[model samples]
Target chain A: MSGLILDFEKPIYELERQIDEMRNFAVTENIGALNEEIQRLEKKLARLRENIYADLTRWQRVQIARHPDRPHTLDYIAGMMTDFVELHGDRAFGDDKAMVAGMAKLDGMPVMVIGHQKGSDTKENLMRNFGMAGPEGYRKALRIVKLAEKFEMPVLAFIDTPGAYPGAGAEERGQADAIARVIYEMGRLTVPIIVTVIGEGGSGGALGIGVGDRVLMMENAWYTTITPEACSTILWKDQEKAAARKTDCAEALRLTAADLLELGVIDGIVEEPLGGAHHDFSAANQALKTAISESFAEITSTPIDTLILERIDKFSNMGVYDVVPADPV
Target chain B: MSWFKKPNSGPKKGDGDRRNIPEGLWIKCDKCDAILFKEDLDRGFRVCSKCGFHFKIGHQKYLSILLDEGSFEERETELRTTDPLQFKEKQNYPDHIKNYQKRSGLTEAVITGKGAIDGRLVSVAIHDPSFIAGSMGSVVGEKIARAIRRSIELRCPLIIISTAGGARMQEGILSLMQMAKTAIWLTRLSEAKLPYISLLTNPTMAGVMASYASLGDFTLAEPGAMIGFTGPRVIEQTIRATLPEGFQTAEFFYERGFVDQVIPRPELKETISRILSYFPDQSMSPESAEEGV
Candidate 1:
């Protein structure tokens, strides 16, 4: 009720609330007929929600990716991982809470899981800085990535953030150096890495952990250098007017999961349920698991030296281009 | 022309030097409208304390502030332009060049040199916005390429403080060629594993910001510096709208993830030194190294 609830989530939340109320009524009154009616209503609601979400615009998808009810990095770990032993501070400074990372078991195979997690509630959001990491968070992620390499474990990063924090303290803590170190280290890492953008993959905050052997994005997620609001504000000084032009902003920012896939910015997109992940998180989690498995299978089977070289080549070729004459001779 | 009888005592004896001086020697701060002594203004890194207006810095002053004292050796010093295009519109290319030379006393927009910042050797190239608005042309590209090569050969970092108004139109395709040329050198520098730091100064735009400036291992900018591929004015014109507050400013880019850091001028030296420390110290004296224990 307090934080932003994406447009699509309102109807889903309402339907869920109704279902809960009906189940409580049936338990209290011993009304078996009411239970049957509730089941039929739930099925009808699910179909309606699916139809509405199936034709979402890029902007609508961006909103869903940032839905407050959606899963964060910690939620994913809680659901899918076993034996998650979180590593602590960056050694240079204090620990960063924005990034949750550690060694964990993915179906009994040891791997490192790291990601930006925006807290669901106000107090936790303050602690996490709304998932925007400072220099320390990136350094922590880098530390675990290096450790993952040493232990011959694959690294899986779940990206979700608007961008790195741009506060004075972040700058003082060598934010740029931390990010550069990660980029350099990730490029040379001998172990396999599979990165997925589960939500808003905004700029360097995303890039700080986004580079890997394979980069995947959720079907409804968005990844871009800047958010639509920021882009709109930049192109038009009127913030209020910009807020009203969300569709144009979305088009200009090229933040859709499909756009990123076409631009070669991401390797693949994991499908989400018709309405959204919030409506069917289990299905979304399964899709993510399958995507990670396929990526790991392809990367882990490659020779270590060759894998490292390929990783280097992968980053080196990013944004590389040759401009030919549009009109041929 | 009433000759001085001690300036004819326009004020009382205890009026404390209240003389209405002529306004030619004073310049107003663009941000705060505070009039300051031109000389004192120059000493404050051209930034006004009251409103923090970043006055245009010349190529020499930029070098003096960035490079270690007495460590700069100028490169391409004798290379002067002869107006290869001989182009003219509202102003002739040769005439504009001559006017800039007379006003700024520089042969080209950029000055390339080898210098030490805190005793760590680096090849420093600075673009002077005063020189034809720091437009990138054939000479700017050539200077940057030479500096990159020198840095790679010497195994030192390459630091470029860029303040450009995009590629020069007079050079036409040649100006665009600079983007590819500089990018190639930057890629080579990357391959060599040498650090290439691009310091975006006020108003880095178009071809410059899109190419080598954006390709830094750690891209940094001065506070309030504007760095973008297209100017806000052009973008606004294309979109038929007004741009955002602080659009293209260093802070905006920092938030948008285009910049690594937005440092103030006073802290720049210390920050750069700290970053240099991440690399192995390469400052051992030649004599001491030769007589190894």
Candidate 2:
């Protein structure tokens, strides 16, 4: 499972595999020349890694974002925070396993941490609904954020869902209504909120719990209203054609973290490790921790009412349009 | 009612049957295959007299139907889309905007303004389904946000008639953020204790439904409107099964406790006026207040 290499990473993996084989051969056979060869190959591997990562296309970054080995929300909390207390249930219906929320401490300061939890394997994926939350999942998130507000704790939310689940049960239970209320409530919550997109920030599902005073995205994460595959399908109006044209759709959508930053949709981009966050978990956690700490400190210093109004203002000024003259009314 | 009622024996509703009806004088009900005079359909507010299905109407028609005569003074008419994402598929996003504007005779999907309902001053925004299925892009979102601000300024109740497929994906994430933008402004309205009434017309689904449309203080829906997060076809594709009859309809939402009331078109004006009467009219002039009473 650790050996899974994406199409773009194949060249780098091949060099890595060759270096490992040469090291083992030199150790067993006591060949001195093979050691020099191994050193040369290691240097080549470093350059290759840098080159590939430096110029990754949006689609390649998307693959890296969804990489199974990439750290999940729980992994970040465990890696960065101290004492953790896991909360559960929306208090209205059955608990949603897809959304995980709890009270936790960050650098000795109390904070509420919430995120969409995707599984590491097939069995766990089904259990987590592939992190596509249902209505109860959002309601659970809403319940905890309110708790965070009452206690006057800052919120750190990690977005990793593909979207709110589109299914019979979700719609029957008022999925849209649930998601809407979350956005509406988050708009006015008293505490400072800092949202970080660690993985796929899917559409309304991501935005359901995404409104914050400081919205940040991981370097490789992609946040868009819809997935490229779905975009292609609707644009081309044919399944097979859509399959072939999704890369173009991804390019056109401009969903990368850097793209969003340039478009002024996010406050900043949290840098990932060299080969992406999946390559070095500790480094990724440290970077995310530093970014969150800075953002939290800045917003917490401001008065609650000013912060809330500014939060609303931040979202209000997101789009670009012209105010042309109109026909007389 | 029997367990199995026989299917109605009538001309099946399809493309061929629709073409058979004369264009100007006669029209066909989409739900039931009842052929009727166009004049009668207009008189009934474009609802099927037999099956009670609400046919999609333009924003101007809604403004006329719901507001007092000549009282609707449109606002935010200057807001226009600029294709911020530079999106293109078979055609460019700007081209699509131009085409729809020409065909629908409107600048955007939603039209916002201040108007009077039963002589009580109120802010109003209505969606035109003819323009891109009333998909909300940046322009639509900003206009709605400004409309909410206008209500706060005027100290009047706000009414929005929504008929949208969802957020406009052509503008990408910018369109998605509009959901948050409008919803956030609505919180200001809520803080002021002003009333917000959202009416869902036919085919209000996805992003628009999940935002301001669902956040209304009082939510009402046209009869038989398709109202949900996901469309029936998409749900069927995901679950790999047939949907039960009347799934995701306005009536279905009402039964599921999502919608406050399922109103028919003809009674819309009277019902809305009655609902508005329940709230205190703070800015009503003496003459208008007497008329309101």
Candidate 3:
């Protein structure tokens, strides 16, 4: 209902609403072709929705990245992955829930899936802290990443969040140290890694599980060094200005999937339906499947060492540019 | 109300109270004989610019100077005291908490946030010495844990600026528990492959120094900063003899290979920036000349 809040399922909702209206009208009138017309309209609506979501603006794409209806880590595990067995605790402290990581099957091949997940409603969000992981979350994700390496499984990470929770309790738990460890470990990881930015990939929160052989972004997703709101606040010192300049912030931050791809921050983009993934879950899932499969197939072709070396090389080259001043006439 | 009230001590000529003149309140710098205004001394990041004598800095000022401009967003703003143990050895826990909160203007000793230094995103946690001598308490531990997790989530480097007077006695064993809690998170971070940098400021000792603070990919200390698990006085007392000169100073630690570098405040940001740039996708030699190796 809010202007900035996008309705990802608009097209589907509209189509369904129209179908209900049409059926109600048919019950009152003796229109013989109404049934046939409704059927045709439904088919047309489905295809049109896909066409609309195929390409989106950077800001629009950011909306999809944080879409509540999109599949989270649990949804992905339930749908595409199988044989998941979650490991618990860092053995040093208690388990943290902001991160859900475990060993799972991807097309019958073993892989580690680690991701940030925000709950559906208020209570769940409070418990998950809107998917802003704390120190324990990072530790949990690290545990799974290490386990994957020990078992020789590929790593798949789904990124979605504003940033890590800046709570006092988290700091006492050594949040910064835990994050540092994860980055260092991933940099030296020998296994193939596939990272996908499914939603709001904000700063270190996204980066925690982001290092991989192939980093992909959903067509309607975003990734950035900091949240737009945070950026705006720091730059303007005015929360109102930050809220007003959300679109501009998204553009400047280069958070969109397309932008990231062009900037070499991401290897590829997974297309969604016309109005976004929420419009047609099946089609979106299929696109994700194909992209993941093709990428895995390509990377898995080489020896594990070679694959890891290539991945490291790929990441190393990112954001590296030699500046050449213009020659004086 | 009258525009001017009568003086409580009755009208007096000149009111010759030299104490009200705001003068002669200077702390002589041990390194330099310069007598500086207490306010000016406090403003110089607790360091004497003339002789470069490092003084103790409060936590907030330390974090501000350490982070890039406009990058900090204080975390855990509210979670305050609960008096878990009702400690009352020297002073009641509640009164101590109130006094600390009033003096430090902070809910806890540790302040955590997301910051950027040289455009490299980092999650920072700093312990405030002003708050009960920067004691490690439950809230401090919680803030540090959160900061670490945030860094891991952001995939940014993590830095903890430590300056503690050991553990918080008020919380008793609960304070010591933070050491294990922090270490566990550090282990998890290590497994995740992120960089953790620890900057030891003035006077990092006791439980905090021994725990996660010592575990860093690159450990740096400010010039003349005191950094050790045990205080020099304790060691000297135990041995019943005087300790070596500059026993726990940053230079001593550096000389002993415990610290990577003893950097100045002005160069701290540049040093961190260079370190971050070194780890970018390129595989440059660790001994690259650009980093002053």
By DockQ, the best candidate is 2
How high is each candidate's interface RMSD, in Å? 13.1, 1.3, 20.0
lDDT of 2 by residue, B69-177 (tens): 9887777788889978888866799999988777667788898987788888888888887788889999999989988998887778999999899999999999999
**CA lDDT, every model vs. true structure:** 0.72, 0.87, 0.68
The global Cα lDDT (0 to 1) of model 3 is 0.68
Query: Considering DockQ, which of the candidate structures 1 and 2 is the better prediction for this target?
Result: 2
Question: Which runs of model 3 end up more than 4 angstroms from their true locations?
Answer: A1-19, A33-55, A324-329, B1-218, B221-293
TM-scores of the models, in the order given: 0.60, 0.94, 0.57
Kindly list the per-residue Cα lDDT of model 1 for residues A142-239, writing each as its tens digit: 89998998998899999999777755455445554565456556666778889899988875567678767898999988876556676566556776
Q: After superposition, how far is residue A102 of candidate 3 from its true place, in Å?
A: 1.3
| Residue A206, candidate 2: C-alpha displacement in angstroms | 0.3
Residue lDDT tens for model 3, A1-329 = 12233655467667878988998898788676799989988998877666656545566776666666766667767778789887666666767667888888888988888988877666877787888887788888888888889988889898888776655445345454566457556656778888888777765556767777888888877676556665455445666776887566555555677666765668899987766666577787778878898998887779986775575456434432122243121
What value does the lDDT take at residue A175 in candidate 3? 51
Candidate 3 per-residue lDDT over residues B177-212, each given as its tens digit:
455456556655776788888898877765677566
Report the Cα RMSD per candidate: 13.2, 5.1, 17.6
* CAPRI class assigned to model 2: medium
Q: How high is the TM-score of chain A in each model?
A: 0.86, 0.97, 0.86
